[model samples]
Target: MPETFLEVGIAFAGIALASLVAAQLRFPSIPLLIVAGILLGPAVMSAVDELRLMQVFAGFGIVLILFFLGLEFSVGDLLSGARRKVLNGLLDFAINFSLGLAVGLLLLDLSPLGALFVAGIVYISSSGLIARLIFELQRAARVETGLILSILVFEDLVIAGYLAVLSSVSGGTEEAASFLQPALALGIVAATIGTARFISRGAQRLLERIVSDELFVVAIFAALVLVAGLAEMVHISSAIGALLLGLILAETGHVERIEQRLRPVHDIFAGVFFLHFGLTIRLENIQAVLAAAAVAAIISILGKTATGLLAGRIAGLSFPASLTAGLTLIPRGEFSIVLAALAVSAGLSPLIGSFTAVYILILAVAGSLLARESLRIAAWVESLRRPKGNTTSG
Candidate 1:
């Protein structure tokens, strides 16, 4: 038992070291954290064995990360953003999802269900990573930022539905049994939204009246866990529940306090989640799919770049700005893993999990580096396109 404590403590110390390196490099810590996990994981040096209880914390970490993400925007804001950006959002989905579907169906020749899962992996971007990158890269104030976030919001909403349908599909073996699960899932989403609208004021009142910090934290945490657990019971994603709860709470006007109280908990869990995820992966499986994973990653990157450029142009951004959108949209971390896990759980293919591990590792690093250099890349492209003597515009 003491040995377990020492091992877990050492793993955590490694997380701190990775975070420090990322901080010094002015890089996003996510990729480095995952790398630390990979290095310490059994597939590599086996410096650290899996800590089972920490895995539970990691699960909460993902929930809290998504929950906090929900707090950043409310239901009203999400609806409004979706309304305004619907067309571009649709364009973005059509272009990128089609690319993923094509790869899954044609390139990999996966089963239809497997193909859909792959398309989903290709479709969703990392809300946690990209949101941070925007501030990190100092592009938060740019015109393109709003468009990118709106697109993210759209994906967030869509993913709930996607997860609903996916959960339905993955859980059932019969063609006829599949239809009802999604309907139930959709109903749950609608009901959740309605309930939030009706009860937000009560929650706000309750929150305001609560004087004890312990009571306040416990209440919120309990609600998050209960909703997430119930969501899983109904065959929908717990993440959907976590995210929606956040959306509801965001409307209560205590966003800062909620974040402040919960951020430390979120960070610790998030680090553990990535580390536990790395521990679960077998490096040999990834090696077998190395060629396919490479092909998929290349296409996925190109597809996202094109989608961003097109979306940015439609919104009337300059080429550099459009390209910046493309570049910034590269990293795929949490959502991609979620989708792959679903695929594997559904008995689709072991390949999907292996493929995603390599895919995420490659893109998370590439995406961060690319996003960091977006301005320079866009500048170079603009310079090449303009007449040799023509001044840059927009």
Candidate 2:
């Protein structure tokens, strides 16, 4: 099932076009690319079999995306949050993960591990999607918005922990000391930051003295991929490593330039990743698990909504703001897809894989719409909260 170059080209081209359409329609581009993949891949147009390569590309995209996100992480910002973001994130994770597991066991008859996988799917949300929507809704600077994003960041850490645990369990590796992995992971992060800081500072000097912007950008990507590979070799997730790398360089004078230069490549590869994910979804498998998919979607949405609101209230957000934050966090993206792929590869029942894909698609769409509507509600609430002297009612 090797793909010809032409097939790969067509598949990607279709994705790009579809994503443009999705943006114009104000829909999530990832799902649109998924639709593109479904149409262009063997199940329909039969245009490509390059999914293996696409998978590799997707992995890189995830790593890069995390790295960029990490660059945005600042200890100062976290400390300034009125509520502890980590605790807020943890509360949301615990509530939603537990509910997801309970639903899996009660409704799907899954074993503990399978139930854990289901919980992982529901616990992880698409930060990229949510961030974009927040910006579009003009809610990015809201106090509640900060809380929501912080929680999302913490959730990523939780997802990383779970992934490590799941990988160890599936691999039948001896459980090392609980603290060992986190210690090693943290050590790697610290080292990455130190190195990146040095490079970022020196790189600008080097570039001003000799290197061109184009050459500097190329070197940055090369460093990113190289560091990511090293992190994987050390048994740490490359995503975390890359994030540390980015953070180290975040304070560099070149932050804006580096981000801008990297955007195009990130956008292109990310599209391929989402498109490949969508394309690989087997409609037949989904058909077989439609009942389970429907149930999973409902539980995930409701649980996430409930958890988001609870966590928001605790974080001092108003009801409408809390509700919007909750809805914004419901779409499972890269992490959910990665978990599904891992489950299938680890020989979990095929039904789990099928169920995840269908469930994710359903939730992503519904969750996006819910987030949009919640934003509107939040805006309305904010208006209502304004002084009567400052407002005119229709």
Candidate 3:
């Protein structure tokens, strides 16, 4: 017991130091924290084990992260203007996902399932990282932000379907059984959303009666955990459940209060989640996959930027704003990691996991720097494109 406490304390101390350094350097803390975890994890110090309490914290951290994301926007917002935005979202997905599939199938010669997993890794940008960048950069109200978020929302819904398919593919042996899992998972997701939409108002009123902060927190946490667990049982990711719960709660009009209270908890746990992810990566195996990972990352960066630019243009953003949107969506984080882990666990290929780790690390760092400097970068590109006589005086 004492040893566990000591290990936990040490881990937190290390994370704190990493966070401080990240702040001092004006870098995204997530990648640094993950690097710190890699340094301290089994590949190096092996200071923390898989069975520790940190695992529990890491799980809840992801749940809280998705939950808070849901609070930022409501279902009505998703429905409103969705028709105009759908094309952009679809284009983004089609381009990026196809690029990933090409890399996996043509370059790596992976099976269809393996290529699908690769597509998932490359297709979706890191919502958590991008959201953090939006807050840190203070660009949430920018013209292109809405389009970027709409794309993310669209991706989230797609992921629900993708996970259902992945689960079915991974678990099924017979042809009919394979189809059943995805169908069941999709049905459950649809049912859950339908039910939430139907009962959201009543749920809000009931929640309003709970006046105490302690009870409110407990109630919300319990409900999130329960829903997340249920989702997992149905073969969908628990994060989706938390996201849906947040979406439902957003309709209640108490999102600001809930967000305010959950912010600190979300921060600590989400950090742990990233750190935990880094801990799982085996650095020794990275060298063998470095070339492939680099190629994939380059393709991912270009494809995502193009996708974002197209999406932004479709939404009526200026070229510079569209470029910023593209840069903002460049980082790949949690979902990529989740998909890679699933692939590895299902014995698709160990190399896939190592490749994913390298790919994510590179893009996460590059994306952060790019996003931070997006305005300047965009302006510089625009200046190069204009004729010498068209250059404007400041």
- Candidate 1 segments whose C-alpha is farther than 4 A from its true place: 173-177, 387-394
Give Cα distance to truth, residue 218, candidate 1, Å: 1.7
Cα distance off (Å), candidate 2, residue 165: 4.3
Over the stretch 286-354, how does candidate 3's per-residue lDDT look in tens digits?
A: 777888888988898899789878887777789999999998899987778767766876788777777
lDDT of 2 by residue, 143-260 (tens): 6787787788777766765765664455443466444665666665555545665666775675465347778778888889997888767666666667767776675666777778
For each candidate, the alpha-carbon lDDT, in order, equals 0.80, 0.74, 0.80
Compared with the true structure, model 3 gives a TM-score of: 0.89
Q: Lowest summed-lDDT stretch of 10 residues in model 2?
A: 73-82
lDDT by residue (tens digit), candidate 1, 1-394: 8878877987898788988998898776766776787788787878777557766777797688778867877767766745567887798799888988987887677899899998988888888789889987778899889878878878877776787788787897677768888888888778767677666788798899878878878888899999899888877777777887887888897788888888887888778777666666677877877888788878888988897899998889988888899888888888777777667767887778777778787888888888989899999887799788777569
369 in model 1: Cα distance from truth in Å?
2.4
For TM-score, candidate 2 versus 3, the one ahead is: 3
